[model samples]
Target: MIEILMWLAVPYIVIGLVFSVTHPDDVRSLEKQVQTQLPAGADALSFGAATLLWPMMLITGPVEEHCDVG
Candidate 1:
């Protein structure tokens, strides 16, 4: 079970690393836009959490667009 879970997670981790490194501009843009819009205490945590939980934001859409709706 542990091995299987590791296998599943590897791809996501690789993709996240590649996306973050390759498209830093998008991440920065999203971070800046979101900081102003997020609740006062949530700004910092939200970005890091969003990156880990929804790595696809690097491809699927802007982090703010996906994360700020809530």
Candidate 2:
């Protein structure tokens, strides 16, 4: 049971780490959208939170809207 659970969790953890590294700005944008600021090492905290809560982050979409008004 433990092994099976570990297998199931691996994908989430790996993907979360990749996302955290690749889209760091998204994490900051999310913090801004939520209107909560953390003092010192906030980026690290945000990355950690994002890694754990990546599924919810995906559901919520990007925090910043990029509308091309041309």
Candidate 3:
């Protein structure tokens, strides 16, 4: 029973971790979509506030921009 339970739990654990990691950007992307519906620049301050509140600014946005290639 333990072995069978472990097998079933493994996939659930992996998918849970995947979704936990991805959930933030899902929120951010939804925010961006809402921003698009508004006039230009409306979401900029909200994003800036969120990014500033976030602890890892040094780790994220710059890397994202660099990855996008001009």
Candidate 4:
């Protein structure tokens, strides 16, 4: 019975590990998206802010209408 239980648990453990490491957020893609939405000739401050806030922006959704790429 113990051996049977271990076999059943192995697949679950493998899949969980795979999913845990596989996040969909790509940093470069996020930067490009930010650039598209930003105003022309915006300062480095704006770019820096977007770089810092990207994870939160992804979680909370875009603050501006044009921020959405698709």
Candidate with top lDDT is 2
TM-score-better candidate, 1 vs 3? 1
Task: Give the Cα error of residue 66 in candidate 2, in Å.
Answer: 14
lDDT string, candidate 1, 1-70, tens digits: 9999999988976766666666565556655666676756454554454546555564577654555433
Task: Flag regions of model 1 displaced more than 4 Å.
Answer: 34-55, 62-70
Per residue, candidate 4 scores C-alpha lDDT tens digits across 1-70 of 9999999877755654443234234333444565666645334434444454545655765454345544
* Error of model 2, residue 65, in angstroms: 6.1
Clashes of each: 0, 0, 0, 0
Sort the candidates on TM-score, descending order: 2, 1, 3, 4
RMSD of each: 4.8, 5.0, 11.0, 12.7
Best by TM-score: 2
Q: lDDT of each structure?
A: 0.61, 0.72, 0.49, 0.50
lDDT score of residue 23 within candidate 1: 59
TM-score of each: 0.50, 0.66, 0.34, 0.32
For model 3, residues 1-70, the per-residue Cα lDDT tens digits are 9999999877765654454344455335535555656657645643544444343433464333443322
Indicate the residue-level lDDT of 67 in model 1: 55
- Candidate 4's error at 34, in angstroms? 30
